[model samples]
Target: MRLPGPHWPSVAGRARADAGPLLLAALVVAVVTVLAAAIPPLLSATADAAVRDAVRRDGGDLQVHSRMEDDGGPSASRIRHPRLAESVDDFRARATEELGPGLRAAVHPPVATVISPTLKITDGSVLRTFQLAYLSREGGPAVTWITGGPPEPTGSETASVPYGAPPWPVQVGLSEADAAALQLRPGAEIPLADDQGNVKKVQVSGIFRPSDSADPAWRLAPALLKPVAGADGRGSTRFAGLLSRESLPDARLAFGPDELRRTAWFTPDPARLSWDVVPPVAAKVVALKAASGSSGARDGSLKWETRLDGVLRDVSAQVEAAFAQASLLLVTLLTVAALVLLLAADLLVRRRARPLAAARQRGMSLPVIGGELLLESAVTALLAAAVGLTLAAVITPGVALSGAGAPGPGAAGAVAPGAGLIGAGASGVSWEWIAPVVIVAVLAGPAFGTLTAARATRDRRVPANRSARRWMRDTARLRRAAAELGVLLAAIGAAVALHQRGTGGGVLPASAPALCALAGALMLARALPFGTRVALKRLLRSRRPLAVFGAARAAATSTRVLPLATLVTAAALTTYTLTLAAALGSDPSNALTLAPAPTLGAAVEGGPAAGPLAAGLLRLAWVVGVTLPVLGLLGLALGAAASAPERWQTLTRLRTLGLRSRETRWVAAGELLPPAMLAAVGGPLLGVLLAHLTFGSLSLHLLTGAGPAPAPPWWGIGAVAVAFVVAVAVVVPVEAAVRRRRRLSEVLRAGDG
Candidate 1:
């Protein structure tokens, strides 16, 4: 025969082809993921460090801040009540008396927000958003050290509608996008917009490049932020493009009365308390992709922050909790993705045993195969890596980095190490640690293929007729059906139980049913013995056509078919669930529903500040409200697609059974009638019982304004029902697609011809 084409080459070639996409995928995902995750922290830490350094260099021990809480002066209400104000005054005095006189403090009126037009672009300068009165217009040593520079100077009352944010908080730098969008360049003048929709023109000043976290403990990439230091010192804060004098308004509601100014951070350091009790509050003055969704710190109390052990700790705790939550979510996503990828790879290898066996018989070495695979993968990864790295660079511009003058190179190195071995967690990305991940990513398919090939060779017993392998090919139903059903039932039950038991009610049930559906669907894939043609024929017989006809056609492949199905099913479910839940579960009063999302956190340093500030409440409520929708919709969509793979097939089979398309869909759905009925009977009852048990209330029966506060509402049932239906609907279509792909003649020919 033809000298069995050198086994090694055949195997190597096959491997390279197979690995190209996966490696590229991994690299693309890893590079972007790491970079995105790195940004916010970097900015926060850098700014924090900058401020601290500035203070230290100035020989200040601590800084203090005081502001009016009510309508805010003159016509403005007092920000602090007498009792609380007295306590605050006393605290500041006590803290300062004890801490020493090295401390200093100054206060600027609470005019933080800036409105600017879209056209302003400045380079090598500051935007001067807020200029302090004492420091600006004075040709002497800053009586008030606003550091980085005083706020923006006053003049512009209008702005062009397209300019971006000015430099804020001193550390976060600027980027090309900000520059271009605002049309700012060094010494360029542009227009700005105010909240009231007013506009004005202003001079282009210097620009601040972005800064990443300087801490070696947890460094991240930087961001583009405009710094607005009245570099020329004119004492005014610019909002939008509107600028106002920094001096207490003899005109504009007499800014923060005299007493307030005396204790303001920019003023005298009365309390002398170490900012250690609270670090700097890095308000997100501009909208950032990094802080998507949870934008705005409208509620004065909710936005405060502090420092702990040289790191961040939230006085509000709400934001901190959210970050922790985000971390958990990311971990969950990573875990699920990795699990699905591994399983899919394993399944693909198993199905491809025949091809692998043929290659091995031709003579191939595993290492050679692996090398070739690695080469293909490396090339793809390198390309994607270059793209991702470049994007990271673009998003995070180089740091201007001169703080109190650029830190010593030694200091920079000591602080940021940038080296692999330094302060990177006690355990981080070690060779041994990476070994498994690498092995899994690089060798999983090949190793598994080899084993499968060996098995196939040992059992190299092809059927006399392809149809003769029916038993092996079509027994998937027997193997997977009952187990899948049981798993799904168990998952639903478990979710209910957890709710009852006061365990995490977030998404546990959703997870369980999803896993059951995926497992069952995958297992049942083996039961499809109709052959490619038979599967296609069935599709022609399917009801409610195109939305589903392709499903069967695509499913014709006997090998690695389930993996594709799994991907589709999971993705569909996740999106559906997320969207549905977000829409339905909006309970503004619940912890899950509160906007400005109050995390039931600790009170501020001086306790609740002042009379009724509706604005503050509205802001707080808005933040809290975000989570409910996100969680609800996400859960809804995910729950629907949980059983997608099987549901899709089930629908397709019905369509093939001579039923009208709509009828076929109805019949397939009929299968879930009993489950739905049961869920209806049970879900609410359980919800009530659990609500009763946990909150000692039976408000679940009531709709809005329902019963006692905090009890799960009656509308929850409707929402859950919708989520369940969505899950079923999404999966059924996939099944319909799969069923319609088969042809009766081909199936018959394969069996008898």
Candidate 2:
């Protein structure tokens, strides 16, 4: 339906005439859309960091260890599970296959034994002996072999004492004190004994030192035993004493899998893992436990009890909750954004009404006009969406989700550091992101256009039956009142429910309050036409020409102003309610109490580190709270801008007719500023009131404790209001100056009415 070739200028000219609203609409849509794309990944990244930290601290995501009986300790025969090696190997292989490269597994020696054997080391001559504890790599990560190497010739496969010789000489690692007493250097052959009267001749393969914090059992005595001095003045190695090493049968005496009889730990790579995979990981843990049956069970003699880190379950729940909330709030914000854009579109279409009528008079069909409008909206939506997505990509990573170092996830005052998982998580955009943005942008434009066209067509299709119109009007009024009453009752119910639910650090179900706020904003729209009528009545009584003209214009435009005002009100209330909830939820005292006891069926007790779940919620609240209002303000600004042209033309006429510049500015401000201010100021107040009504003293208490509610950022809100007023006041004179370059006839021709 678009005009072709030479006639295309008219289409382009009409677009330019409505450029202010189009651009403003695009800006509003872009901001909201970008936020929707960016928030989920950011929240997920934040929650992942919390989970990662928990896993790191707890050792791994899951632990499988032997569950020993409490009676003294298990007997030697019972403790030595011959099936342990096979079962562990099977479990590891299966888990690795299931979890893929993302799995990170580590084996830990039993907590009851951090040291291996206290071995008797002796000199060859007369068996001069020193007893000292030995530590292997599995025992002490801090143990550093100082010289020669790993004990040469790790023990052979045979379970008998005085076993077969290793590839190299039998070897043992000794601490400095042990080596000094034995007078043995690295590579020196030393004799060692076990309690079974079995003797093994071994080399002192390495002398090592253990960290101060290593088990005392792993360290040599403070002083070394000295042998009688020889002619060279060095202590003699010759001695006469029996030696032995004390240890249980089947104890893991080597680092290899065959001797690894205790417990094994497995964890997935936190960077690769997400909350969704927790259940499968848990299932693997359960399977491993089941495979390693109880101590005497015939299925498998090895007894393995598993403890998946408690944090996994909690963080998983929290992340899931956060994403759920994010999805809900995202939908709400988008709905508001669509409404704002629709209003702007409607205003733009109204400006084109005269031109459309002129085109129709010249024989242009409705289909052609519809086609051109669709093309315009599609191009605009696509351009705006691209800008929005690009902007989201650049700015999203700066949002901090890693609430680190705060006393758990719910720590009150800690803002998450701006780095950490952002680099690793959701740092980039993919097609999963691009597709939604394009679709929403495309859908938003057509949505607003169709609604606006419906209104315009309805107006043109009005029938000429006065009685029928009266009856229809009355029915519409009754329906509106019933709707308003229903909304009011719903708002009260929601407020009460919110109060009850949100009290004492509980999760606030936001849907009800959000609905209440939306309804309240629409209800507030009723005041606009009444206020405009009264103001017009008073203005008509004034002697001033600007007042009379401005008042008349305001009365004429009240229909357009009311719907925009309602949208502004809803956006403001939603923003304020969300912000208030965020503030309350983020307070340290208000953190949800994580389970203080261990989950059923798990051996370990107590909860994971506090704050991850709470912290994530805080971040969600802050993001939504801050973004919602900005969306509303953008809509408000665009709404104001769309109406500016008609108001400016009136001001220019007043200026030309003999009114002073200041009076013209005043008249322009008088017409435009009230509805914007009322929506902006009233929306937040209405929101807070509704929130308080729903959530009660708990809402207020969460914000401030025993004192007055911490003041809302009124100064910021006021600044926005003042800036809006000043801009409206300034634009009238600025446009008059720009239009001074045009002839008076041109100004007259620009009038929409």
Residue-level lDDT tens digits of model 1 in 35-133: 322322222222233223332333221223333333343332332222332333443443334322232122211112211122222333344342212
User: What TM-score does model 1 achieve against the real structure?
Assistant: 0.35
lDDT to native, each model = 0.33, 0.50
Number of backbone clashes in candidate 1: 120
**1-753: candidate 2 lDDT, tens digit per residue:** 944432467668977988877787677667765765565455555555555555556634343334322112223212223343344445444434433332333222222221223334433444344332222223333556677655432433433332232312234566666567656788776666544444544556676665553443222222222233331225533222111121212233322113223333343455555443444454455555566655654332344454553445544444443443444455456556656766676667667766666665675555566666767776877788667667765656443223221121222111221112112234344233334444544554445444454454454544579987888888988887787788677756645654554322222334455556666666657777777788888877888777777777667666563355544555455645464544445355434422121211111212333344444444555556666566665565556556766776776676677887678677776776666666666766765665445434332331223223433556655654555456556655665565557655776885631
* lDDT, model 2, position 364: 55
| Deviation (Å) of 604 in candidate 1 | 21
lDDT of 2: 0.50
Model 2 residue 8 CA deviation in Å: 5.4
Candidate 2: segments with Cα more than 4 A from true spot = 1-13, 59-61, 66-261, 267-272, 286-302, 306-309, 391-466, 475-515, 535-555, 561-563, 570-633, 644-659, 690-711, 724-727, 731-753
RMSD of each: 21.5, 11.4
